[model samples]
Target: MKHSLIFITISTFLATIILTHQTSSIKCFDHPNPLNFHQKIPVNCEFATRSLKTKRKSSNDKFQIKFTCGMDDKKLCDKVQKGFESAGQIITSTISIEIPITIDASFYDFCKTDNQCSIDNNVVAGGANPARTIALMDEDGVERYYPQALVKQLPFEHHPNFGPFDILAKFNSEADYWFEGDDSQIKPEQADFQLVVLHELVHGLGFYSSWNDFFDFVNPKGLTPIPSVEGEVKENMEMIFNGFIENIFDKYLVILSSGEHASNITTIINTIVNEKGKFYETPKDFIVKFKSSPQYLQSQIMLQTATTPFALGFLPKNANSPSEAIVLETTLNPYQTGSSLGHVDYKTYVNTSDFLMTYKQDSGLTLGDFMSIGGNYTGGPIGPRLRQVLKTLG
Candidate 1:
């Protein structure tokens, strides 16, 4: 009965669709089919995953990204404390200077309670983290760490724009925690607590913008092969996620890419081309070139212009409402060809806000710098708040 109840809740949540546009009907908004060229191309997650995985294990000197601790151990905590202090008096008033780190699997086990916790979209997958609070600075000075589950049970949504914006980690499968401050899971040197703190601090601050993770239209069918151009476009998609853009994980970003059938790719691409500039616009069902013609890209530009004000908290409605946005250049179909099409879905939470911010400030910083800063520093207050609300639980 409990399992059935959980299934019902999950189904209802997945089936839920929130469209914020004032227009009565959903239209392409532009003509000439901006994504006509790449309509029927094959694409899949395994191909992209394989490519990314291969890149991770390659010997070639490609773009090698790594996370590093910002300050030396001696000043790490101090630097983080100071960052909190700069944000507001809340850091000193609520969180303490000295934090406690505890690891308990039992605490995480309790997070599965329906009333207490829900899956964290970020880590929901094979070997995923079980429910629990990985880290927390409570009202007292004590910073607590348990399995991921305990943290999942926290009552208040850290950000109001998104639902139950508590901090949690979704897992790929049943596995141990990723950051253990030990060499076994991750090298102690690689723990980068300062980096994590900065990232979370941004979540603590809140976000004022919205994002599209580009996972809605292209559902993975395992039959179609991801094209070479698709890989490059995917990287560009990431380019849009840098800096402050990553902070809005709490926003309900529509998955504009991904589909169970081949036509879904074209749908996503069309959306992409329709909403080119200004961020959060998509052509949904079109897959044209990144450097395609300007006229073809106008649809996207218009979509961006129309959506920008709402995403930036100037929508003339609820300032705390989750703004609408479209995902482009990625796939979300998570089923095999023989599997039911209904089971496949396109959508993912904003993993990080740096991509969007970096895109906004491309002229000022290198891509690597943008990523590094995104991983290391928390964005402004509003971005993190939005991130908490939009984040997905697998």
Candidate 2:
């Protein structure tokens, strides 16, 4: 099964890096030190708020990052704060934009006993941590209100001149993070804190897919993109909906074959569906035709129904590689959703010197030619193609 292959392949890949490392013994305190709540936002005061670094004036051109730490280990919080501050500086220096962006995020921890994590002050603890890899745009491929998480969690307010914080990441209180610099040798059991922070920050800055919208419910349960609306459609007579969206990582995507401009994930399905009204038995034979297919990426944003719905080449930065063509993950499985359609084509680029946005941080690779802008993220600057993609988004 596809699920089995994905897990086996990724585990085998990361095992090489993790198998050789060892964990250092650190003394454990009774409980994590609680963060001070003075000067914190009103919504959630469970964590204490601190301004790590306010590099630029509170203007539209600068970026502001507020670190809310809710952990017993003040030292770990300080290190994580420093890592984010470094990444924030790199983003600020990239271009002197007129509009400032403020990121309001919290880094907290939980107590893990045996194999389970105990709940922290925040509402939903243990089961899942609230490390939101957020996107400011509407995630639904359709009109609005795709995921319930977004509907209830819209920004309470946005600054006068600057936009709202695109990212709001929180961490588990008991998570083990490599606190030292990148050069520090990471044992098999230790995770590079800086590397993890850098990767999550990239996703927060719009390096993810809204492709999940296809499977998620549209405005309501009854409605579907059944007769998927490409441009505009009349739903139930009164409502006229325009399903085309122009933001998020998936929308700004450009296919390598120089075909039509794809604005959403429905173009391929819509094109093929229009022909056979169903999925092709053999998916391999459909790739070339899909690329050569006409300009129809704007038909429907939320894919209501599909026989075989899979993500396209949105994640593969090097789809144009002459060495070998990229193959996309078309089948959607619940277990593999995060690793599936949302990431780079790891199978194709794993062994090559291509993009580095796979499931696991292969932190084994390095790049030097492109760090002149701002000498930050020294150990792992954004990959060449990923950098290009980010620039294209702007």
Best by TM-score: 2
* Model 1 regions lying over 4 Å from their true place: 1-201, 213-299, 302-394
Q: Give candidates' CA RMSD values in order.
A: 21.7, 15.1
Residue 249 lDDT in candidate 2: 49
Per-residue CA lDDT of model 2 for 1-394, tens digit only, reads 0011111111111111111111111100010111110111112112122223422355433656777887677777788788667666655565233334556656654343233343341121111111222213333433221111121123323311112343455454454445545455544444445545555555545444434322222221111122212211122222111222233445544343442234434444444555633333222233233334452333232222211233345533434442222333334333242344334565554443333445444332222221332243443465445555555444
* Cα deviation of 298, candidate 2, in Å: 13
Candidate lDDT values, in order: 0.23, 0.36
Task: Assess candidate 2 and give its TM-score to the true structure.
Answer: 0.49
Worst 10 residues of 1 by lDDT: 1-10
For candidate 1, lDDT tens digit of each residue in 1-394? 0010011101111100111111211111110111111122121211111122222332222211112222345453343333223322322232322112111111122234212333442221111111111223334332222222223223432411111212222111121222212344332222222223223332222211212222222332112111112112222242221111111111223322211222222234334325653232231212333325343343343234223222111111123222333232123223211111111111222234324311112122322343454464354322443333323210
TM-score for each model: 0.22, 0.49
Specify the poorest-scoring 10-residue window by lDDT in model 2: 28-37
